[model samples]
Target: MHIAAQAYGRTSKTGLPTRELEATLLSQSAARLAAARDRRADDFALVVEALEENRKLWSLLVRASSAPESELPDALKQNVAKLGAFIFQKTIDLIENAEPEGFTALAEINRNIAAGLRGIPADA
Candidate 1:
């Protein structure tokens, strides 16, 4: 079964979907659980920061996408590209400092964000 469908599916016995349960696991209440499972606080921070950076990059992408391609100044595009590169490098540096668990967390968050952005039209 698809992950989303499985996640939201109700158990045959209890007739309760796992969505709410899974939400709690990934929610703020799961901080301890995340820490226990990962066994490192630095990894958790990397995950959180990567998620945040993804959001910031998303905003930039949306703004640039809305602007007319012809009207978008070369300098503006260059600056955005440069900023993205800088952020990417910073993310790499952060991952390097983190342990394996932390690096995995960062990579997962970054991949999810990238996948989400890929679904949206670049020109939109």
Candidate 2:
């Protein structure tokens, strides 16, 4: 997925609202990570692939949020950047350790962010 092409709060070429597109992407990534974690014993490669995809998504979000042209408030931008850094570190740790519990945090973070983008509560 060329997530870099999808700008937040705008309509994308696919006609979906970019916010919704982002939410969908996050949700999908979360699902993939969760599934891969569950099946890691069967195919560890799936976990690696899912983690890579999630890292790419977070890279796009961190870059966009940190861009000078971004409309996000400084606090929000900083928070997102911090979260991205954590995500990146966690991804590396999981890649090296292959711990199933590590995937849980990543999936939860994606789900919470997706819910926020959709204007819904994370626990909903």
Candidate 3:
């Protein structure tokens, strides 16, 4: 299955929306988690699968945020790095104590970030 090609919407010749990749990734992760939860059949590795994809996403953000040439403000980069670190630690925690409860926050975070990426102004 070609997930990247089919899962997310097609990219225009000009370019995708800012943070579209992150949004698409989060959308897929959310769907995966939902499907895993909905499964009547055994879902032996769902936690690992969902968390791993999310972990990779956050890792990419951390790397991008902290890059020396990154145009993002220092404070924003620091904040993102902190959140990335928290996500990393939480990934381990969820692995050790796997449950659906831990999944909500991660999904919400992704959704919220994706919302921001869509150019919605956040409330102060």
Any runs in candidate 2 off by more than 4 Å, and if so which? 1-11
lDDT of 3 by residue, 4-117 (tens): 433334556537653777677767776765565454136648767777777877777788779988999999999899988888987888777666666666776777776677
Worst 10 residues of 2 by lDDT: 1-10
TM-score winner among the candidates? 2
Error of 3 at 36 (Å): 4.0
| CA lDDT of each prediction against the hidden true structure | 0.44, 0.87, 0.70
Across 27-112, the per-residue lDDT of candidate 1 in tens digits comes to 42224323433644535664554434443443444354346663657786665566456545545554455444543543444343
Ranking by lDDT: 2, 3, 1
State model 3's lDDT: 0.70
Clashing pairs in 1: none
The better-scoring model by lDDT among 1 and 3 is 3
User: For model 3, which pairs clash?
Assistant: none
Per TM-score, what order, best first? 2, 3, 1
For all predicted structures, in order, the TM-scores are 0.33, 0.89, 0.76
Model 3 ranges off by over 4 Å: 1-14, 37-41, 121-124
Q: Write the per-residue lDDT of candidate 2 for residues 2-81, one digit (tens) a residue.
A: 54344443454469876788788899999999998898888888988999989988998899789989999999999999
